[model samples]
Target: MNSITVLGSGWLGFPLAQLLSKEFSIKLSTTSSSKFENLKDENIIPFIVDINNLNGDIDKFLSSDILIINIPSKNIDGFKELIKHILNSNIKKIVFISSISVLKDETTPLLEIENLFKKTNLEITILRFAGLIGYGRNPAKFFPNGKVVKDADTPVNMIHRDDCINIIQKVVKQDIFNETFNCVAPSHPTKKEFYTYCAKVSGLPVPTFDSSKNESNKKTVKSDLLVSKLNYTFIHEDLMKIVF
Candidate 1:
């Protein structure tokens, strides 16, 4: 069986590692030692890795055939050191869990670090996921009862955590690499429509939007490349259907 190492066992990484453990020999990394036994109970080999500090047995963690980096840290120097270690290790393929936020701003650290990974010789796939939703992470909760939310007309670029995991699984399983793809739902709904529905479903107070703000050039993300290249279908394509 092929071995895979998942760096940063947080929200998305933890569940991803759990699912991948059934098919591949999985090694999961966590910054906290408290989660070590939890990972073990799920049949995932655990490692205490802190990329920001460059601490832990990274060499051993990189022993797998494939590496999945899901950390939220944006430290350029830390990733620089991690990349150096990767070049020296047995990790031939990498699936980087980037964010669509990189497109929103050029100054974003993820874009700079992404460039660093692009120059490497190893096969790498960069998945830029939009605002993560699902698994009790409802967007409605972002606004309190009477909080005024802006961008009422602006379209929301978001993805479900389940779809995020499935897309990564497809990329790794199909050997898709050296490509950058946006992971977002095809349905682009207005923030007001989406959040109002979410709030009603979750029994939360509906957020009020500021209609005074005119959003002519609203930023919306598309997953055309992902759909075309991976031939993948999003499980949560309709944002309105998402229930908490």
Candidate 2:
């Protein structure tokens, strides 16, 4: 078992900390000073530290065998300094919790970071996730109008809370070096199609399709490799009906 450190102990980080601590030594870090007690109660070693405010304590944090970067893209700039600092530490492996948004319509900085990790001693694993829909964390919040994007035919990719943690557990055990996997549900449903389903299920009004430019383009995510290799099955593949 490795000494694991999760950098951002938020929603997904808490679960990952719990998952990893069962088999490894865990040190979960977060910006929240108040949450560390809960983490300690959960049997996780909690460190209330912010990467942005670090003054060399990063070296202390990277003292683990594996460093899991759970901070979001808004803090991606910190990653540049983080990778540099990790090289100076005892850590040998890294797992970055990135998002499937990188695969969207724009060029992303992840590819560059992926290349940076590849050149180092740090054996890195990148988990690119899709729409994360858990209890209070709902994607429906983004589409509050009970309407999805214009491309009604565009498929929606999602993975449940339990499945994400489970897959991360499995992937770490493999000791695979420098692997990037898209973490998403196996099912893909059209945008409008799924939205209407959710609206009906949630007892909300079925939004009128405006036939606007957005209503016509298809956006999909690919994760065939994750499913075939890990045998990952999603608990909530289609939330449009169940979540509402």
Model number with the top lDDT:
1
TM of each candidate vs. truth: 0.96, 0.85
Please give me the total number of clashing residue pairs in predicted model 1: 0
Local distance difference test scores for all models: 0.90, 0.72
Candidate 1 C-alpha lDDT tens digits along 1-244? 2899999888899899989998898988888889866344555788889988776588998999999999999999999999999999999999999999888789999999999999999999999999999887889889876889787888989999999999999999888999999899999988889889999999988988886666654888899999999999999989999888
Task: List where candidate 1 sits over 4 angstroms from the true fold.
Answer: 40-42, 214-217
lDDT of 2 by residue, 24-123 (tens): 8888887877886544445577777676666656677777888888876454466677778888888888887778876763457765666667778678
Q: Global CA lDDT of candidate 2, please?
A: 0.72
Measured over all alpha carbons after superposition, the RMSD of each candidate to the real structure, in angstroms, is: 1.4, 2.7
Count of backbone clashes, every candidate in sequence: 0, 6
